[model samples]
Target: MGNGAKAQQRRERGGKDAGKGGKSQLKVNEASKSIVCGTCRQSFMTTARAPALTAHAEKHSKALADCFPDFKV
Candidate 1:
């Protein structure tokens, strides 16, 4: 087969399923952690990294405090 034809065959076959690896292929082994905001009573994915969660909390603090003082940080 020509190079073009070989390439077409490879494309048709598709590469190994990238999505079928690691945590994706299997179900989550452990329950996800939870984040409860003291000021807003909002719950977030505790599974997310601490830095990301901190950034998210920082962004929402102003709005949350304004809306619900009971839950504000």
Candidate 2:
């Protein structure tokens, strides 16, 4: 019930090191309105009227599946 115990609980539930020491997993470029994938390092631009981010994520998922056929995402 102390500070150490509370920190330990947070760590167990993936709160303390979830972002690898308070760093973001995604790198966003505000000027270009685009995001670069943290894992594969792929970059893409966004549109005004469509959900381009979702499509880009799907590409990452597909690439992951192709690279690791036996692994479950």
Candidate 3:
């Protein structure tokens, strides 16, 4: 098969295990306007904004980093 065909085939095969691991466990609480981390069960008020959610997620990421120095979230 040609290169383009091979690339298309790979895409059809889900690009070789694209989502095998490393999934986000963050969940949003619409009623309370907060985001909670599934791993740590930590919650923070989001005020229905992206920045707040991002900041809260970063906190969880930092906590994970403390445990695993090389871990990326």
The residue ranges of model 1 lying beyond 4 angstroms of the native Cα positions read: 1-33, 60-73
lDDT tens readout by residue for model 2, 1-73: 8999999888889865676665553554445544455556654444322244445557667553343333232
lDDT of 3 at 35: 48
Candidate 1 lDDT by residue in tens digits, 1-73: 7999999888777766644656562234233435556656655554555555566567776444343334323
Q: Which stretches of candidate 3 lie over 4 Å from their true place?
A: 1-34, 62-73
Please report, in order, the local distance difference test score of every candidate based on alpha carbons.
0.54, 0.52, 0.54
Highest-TM-score candidate:
1
lDDT of 2 at 17: 60
Stretches of candidate 2 exceeding 4 Å from the true structure: 1-34, 46-50, 62-73
Ten-residue stretch with the least lDDT total in model 2? 64-73
TM-scores vs. true structure, each candidate = 0.31, 0.27, 0.27
Looking at candidate 2, what is the lDDT of residue 3?
Answer: 100
